[model samples]
Target: MDPPPPPQPPQFSLIPPSQIPPPQQNSNPNIQPDSIPNWDQNPNLTHYLDLSVPKKRRRGRSQRNSALFRSPLTLNASSNNDLSSYAITSSSSSAAVAPPVSFSSIRNPPPSLTQSSSAYDFSDEIIMINKEPKTEAMIALSAGFPADSLSEEEIETGVIPVIGGIEQDKTPTEPSKPGVIIIGAGLAGLAAARQLMRFGFKVTVLEGRKRAGGRVYTKKMEVGSRVGAVAELGGSVLTGTLGNPLGIVARQLGDVLHKVRDKCPLYSVDGKPVNPDMDMKVESAFNRLLDKASRLRQLMGEVSVDVSLGAALETFRQVYKDAVNDEEMKLFNWHLANLEYANAGLISHLSLAFWDQDDPYDMGGDHCFLPGGNGKLVQALAENVPIFYEKTVHTIRYGSDGVQVIAGSQVFEGDMALCTVPLGVLKKGSIKFIPELPQRKLDGIRRLGFGLLNKLCHSCWWSPVDCFSGR
Candidate 1:
């Protein structure tokens, strides 16, 4: 038997050298014979020696055992059955080398590795490695199995491993756009919803009332021969035309505006018209007093005790009371009532210093009335908006994840919530907040007052002459 080939020199490698073919010869004339040996053809030998070759291994569980003897730190299996196939040398030695193993492929291991019948399952072993603190040996073993290979349950529980002092995170694909919940489908809320929708956000508006226009109600009534006359119940006039948002919307809607004439006839409670000359004198005096109050406020700056506008006007009125009769005094009182009406607050409650703070930003130009009433503007804004009427949102719970609004029997959830409810509603504590509103906001809501005005529309057939003749 030729002395059994000298006992094969005690082959230390698991793979026999007889099975590994010789390095193929280069066909190109320019290639030197001394060039680096192509170890890809001899994977068994390369794996045994733990050689760092440029070429990658084939993709499959069959090739997993090819690197079984790569390092002592690497997990091992008792069975060598799977290793026998790779041990058999490649028949086509001149085949092109495979590409290098991608990081993604390493992260997402082959499915067959989990279904292996070996004594040791690499999937379980990888979980065990992740549980233990990262060490040099564990990292060396973890190189073959990445953290992403773990199941979703393990990943959610944070069983990922840290390699080279850097913890690897499974970066999932980005989620879809966020959705917003809007409370109170008022002008502010509707406007915000439209803006957010334009920016690719999903919006839902919840209105407590059956109709969208909060506090803006318009009704049709018969006036003399006219069948349908527009009667404004709230916010009748658009205060200004220039730089007014409502004016802009009106223009966009192609609606005509009737400019209110600057002619207002003053009458006493008894129906007798006041003398124009006396009205002008009282009005001029009232305006002078307001200008004087403004100058006094500028000189005083801030005061410890807040003074009401009524108190200042009353002091000036006392000086003028001696120069006027009861009728002129009534005109003066009427002017004060007008101021209260304009501010929607009593003169006694109006702050003397900060009451006119918003005056500088007041829109300029003629105050006009929309033909169909302000309700048309509300209808335009409500157009195409996803509004849930009569939602009656009562509770708002907000957190890091998102917001939850409890409206009547329904609970609405969204990525964020916008609260545009009226100040009166907030002050009344009609809606309950989960953690309660901030103290600062609560204080402001308490300090700020709200008022309402009732409009009574009367249709009269009598002319101006008939009214003066008591008809």
Candidate 2:
């Protein structure tokens, strides 16, 4: 028989890059509701305990060329933002001569014990979930958190969740702190939960969205003549696989990686591609400029312990002031914009160290998209994990033993808590914390900035290109 078909891609409604799903048509044909005869329906705590056998490491597999590129961007030549940090291209301007403006920028489950079988045990819980009462009682019973308020001073300070009464039952042997509360069901929070779960600790995740899977987004698109393909609108590319734990998880979950190309799209100011033959001189000059950038990078590295990318770049500009022609300078500057945007943030706020940390060369990784869009990875991760959706945290108070969280009048206590809130939410002070946070964490919070990225896809059923990256 011919090979079977894969499941239909999800009907992603709005793939939000804002740090955080849709219609359902049964894609499978011969599938019956009772196809899996022995699936479990109740909440089975035991299933979560099942662990897979660790894969043995090969002798010299070169660690699959980790996405981390210690090599410099000047060397990679592949101009696609995929290989750069933060996918920060374009907002960087392929237009070097153009003035700086603003710009924004998974799981698995096991078989054996199924959800149906657990239904008997969790029947009441299911009813409770659907009922949506003031979650205070559930949080009280599930986490032992408090319902107290916090001071404005505490709100201003960024602090990690403190340990208190919620930790009373917590043990060092456990993977997670018993009383820990994890808010937000996206990749960061989920990853924290997975790590904690490995230590055998129970976790509570409060998701503001009605669904799990935070920023990794996918949506239906009129991608050329193709009716549907999972196009990632947020958190689209994977970087630094060699060291990025997330990248590793992505591949294990079967995400697809698209190679980034160096041949940049030349535009005629109106954004249409310029004829290659006509643009050959400029393209070749762009290539020569790459050579100059490599030398500049080396010079900057030798200059000082503390220097910003812009400063170093300025120095480089001065060095080449009288060296290259004005036309060449325009092309050279444009390519630098491409390099800086790889991190996707304001140029003024960026630094050489940030680029070094993002390190796209040695740390430079091959770029690719998730096969079914990043949404697939998110769903796989959350398939069977416990997530309470549409639950926004309101107040937090810490006691001698544990931390308490208040969400819609419901209280939960946990030994430790992980709040993977977006920078925007935290800045707005939407959720309050008591006992005050330390100054250090708060500083990090204030200093760190979140970037915005947008993609507006259409039913371009008749486009010349196969896929669009908005280059």
Candidate 3:
């Protein structure tokens, strides 16, 4: 008979409760709330986009199809709140919710490597003729297993013999809790989470809505391609370099691009064909309006107030009066609507400073989604991450020791947590934080305005070129 094989170290196990403490929130006046608009305060002008609504049934068939199967999926078009922004509130320790029941008592699975002595022995599948290195032995054992998800115990001791996939004896050294708690699951939150995750701290992302990818919705519809495709119902344009990490990641992992047509025929506000040359007049007038609005924002400097894009355009009416056909105003309105969606709100609400930071004019080529939509990037980010659908993180607590995160009454512990919630939620005082954040951080977020940028994704079929006023 063959001799018995060598023994391996203990396998990974969940963190014990004795080591964890009760939940708490650190809030005070020092952590002032953000002055930006809240989600509830935002408006929904895009109701016309939802075809399922009873009123939309009145539209013609072609218009319905065009809206439903719109070429550019509205995913990530930001059909979300326009009053989005982060805020930090000051408060003394508030009420602490009970810890998740299964948090501490959850049983850890038996060590995979510590099974019965007579169990099947792990065999090595050698690729090379003579693999003598112990590294090779370790690699052979680690096949088909996740390395990043391993426990701290496994990462440190390294002695645990690998079993089916994980090192049982090892446990992750819990991460530190963060000062600030963020809410929402938008691009901004994702970017912040990605950055903070790199640090040795934990983040709690409290998302009020059931689904993630806030405003960047990518729904799979059975249309477009043979197998059907994912379509966007929100913001569809991505311009500039740094402001568009999704564009880069898409090209790298998905090898996709927004294939914008060489030229989109100009249309009158009333949907009539128009000459692109005349668009120069439109662009010229629009430019001045933008410039004036930008200057207004700079002058205001603080405290957000609302402004209307339509009103701004009114000042330039006389400039195009000579070319004014009956449909000129309608054409102008349609163009303005598309631009409004581009910014997700009126230029008046848009922070010129933010725009400059996100995508400076003439800096790089503007980007759009693949025929499917920008949801591809969100799907890619979620591929390996351990995310729960419909899961909502409620409270976040961090201290000198490890981090604690509460989601839908379930508390999860980790060496470090990365809170990737949107700034809007943070501003609203939705989730509680332990150890009040420094005033500097609070002030930064306080001043950082987050206005809502909502979009409605649905479609309207082609109606008469002049539906309202007879042509």
Listed in order, each prediction's TM-score against the native is 0.58, 0.54, 0.44
**Full candidate order by TM-score, most accurate first:** 1, 2, 3
Which residue segments of model 3 deviate by more than 4 Å?
1-214, 223-226, 240-243, 262-270, 274-278, 288-363, 398-403, 413-417, 434-471
Model 1, 1-471: lDDT tens digits are 455542121111121223222224223233233332222333222211112221111111111222321211112222332111111111222222222333222222233322222321233333344454331122212233233233232222221223224543332233235889999877788767665664467789999999887776666555555534566776677665643566655655557777766767888778999899998888778877775455444333354026666766666555455226767877777777667656677777767666654442344456678876777888877876789998999999998989999998899999999999989899889999988889998999998876667566665444321111011
lDDT tens digits by residue: candidate 2, 213-266:
777666657545564544566676664343344454454443445554535566
Candidate number with greatest lDDT: 1
Q: For candidate 3, what is the TM-score?
A: 0.44
What's the CA error at residue 257 for candidate 1, in Å?
1.0
Q: Who wins the TM-score comparison? A: 1
**Model 1: runs farther than 4 Å from truth?**
1-176, 222-227, 320-323, 458-471
Model 3: per-residue lDDT, tens digit, 347-366?
44433334322221121333
Per model, how many backbone clashes are there?
Answer: 0, 71, 63
